[model samples]
Target: MTFLNRQIHFTAAPKRKVLVGFILFLFLSFVIIFVEPFDTDQYHSDHKILVLSGFGILIFFVFVIYSSFENLWYLKFRKVWLVSHEIASTILFFVVAGSVLYLYNGLMINQGSYSITSHLLYLKNIVLLMIPVFAPVMLYLRQQFGERIVPLPINSVLLTGENKNEVLSLEKGNLLFIKAFENYVEIHFLDEQDQVVSRTFRQTLSNVYQQIPFLEKCHRSYLVNMTTAKEIIGNSQSAKISFIHGEKTIPLSKTYYKQIKNRLVQK
Candidate 1:
């Protein structure tokens, strides 16, 4: 269960999906032509190529549809793709594509005279053949083209305000602290020249905090980047935070003193 829940790289690239479909079509056609699987050898030589092409086409369409749906589900929910998702989708592809191909064989080639037992047997054979080809190709494509989910580094953060075009992009290491005043918050950070600078954005502290959760909340109105903090001064009852780059000190509320102290100790 734990292994299935592990996140994996995934891709919804249209070109890659189409390439996969094309590869499967070619592979299936080649196998059917050379191996003469099932009732292929019994078909008339004149119509054999056309009939075999239809089987490949069916597989291609099914693969495209399956991949498109998977891509759509990912876009809609924005969920991380996991091992379980990959496994389930693979099983679904085998069942759906295998069943369709079996029915196609029966109707087009066998004159629709296949029994239930024969259908199951055909499906089983199709699945067995597909497993060796499909699984490795998908794994290779995913490794080559799939996108991994990764968090934005602290050095590259874009702070946006409620007003249009109000934004600040800076390294979190240079950020000192944020001070809240009702609907506005002041972001203090060091400039490239090592000077303390402040920017006022028309956004509440809560909203800003949501954007950068790594910032530690020391008081009701302040969110400090602990990376810039030099040390905690004064006692627990009246604690204050001193920064390495600025003369100003942030007040530490009793509500968050212990938690902040523990975090600072860990740092």
Candidate 2:
């Protein structure tokens, strides 16, 4: 249960998911042609390639559709995906894809005479055989093409102080972190010359966060721009956020440690 609850990185891009599906199609086709795991010998030699290619095509479509829907679900909910979600999806894929393959084999290969018992047995065999191949390929592809940075929706943000006139316009990427001092919040960001600079504003940290929701509240008095965060150093009890271009480190409270860690994993 603990392992399943552990947070893991997820690949949500449609293009990358399609790419993975295409690669899996080629791999399945290759396995059918050479490995002959699915009783390819029963079919006529001349039509073997065509018949086996059908299996790969079905797999490709199922993977693309399933993965795309999963991505859509995540996007709709805006929730953090965990290891349990990955495991559940994998199991669901096996059942869904296996049923499709079983139907294809029965109607096309067995002339609608394939029995349910046989389908069950073959499904078991296929699952066992695929666990080794599918797991590694998916893992490798995700690691290679996973989303590494959080994209900014806008170029710049206008942060206003208590007085409407006290406003600071900053590039989304240049902003580093915000620190609260009593009633005033200090904004730290990079300038045009790529130098660290600070500006003081009469605003509450909470108000600043509402204006720039992308900034992560790592501490009660601090909100860090996770996009600029290079890495998090330290453990669950206490952690520090290091920026990509700045020496400044933001204190990560124990309360937000897990949340910050999950965000970094997505990165």
* Per-residue error (Å), model 2, residue 91: 0.8
For candidate 1, list the clashing residue pairs, or say none. Answer: none
Clashes of each: 0, 0
Encode model 1's per-residue lDDT on 81-174: one tens digit a residue: 8888888878887888888888898877767786888878987876667678667876676556777665456477778899998889888788
Task: Give TM per candidate.
Answer: 0.54, 0.53
Assess each prediction's global lDDT (C-alpha) against the native: 0.83, 0.83
Stretches > 4 Å off in candidate 1 = 76-79, 113-116, 151-267
Could you give me the TM-score of model 1 versus the true structure?
Answer: 0.54
Off by over 4 Å in 2: 76-79, 148-267
Assess candidate 2 and give its TM-score to the true structure.
0.53
The true-versus-predicted C-alpha distance at residue 12 of model 1, in Å, is 0.3
- Superposed on all Cα atoms, model 2 deviates from the true structure by an RMSD in Å of 14.1
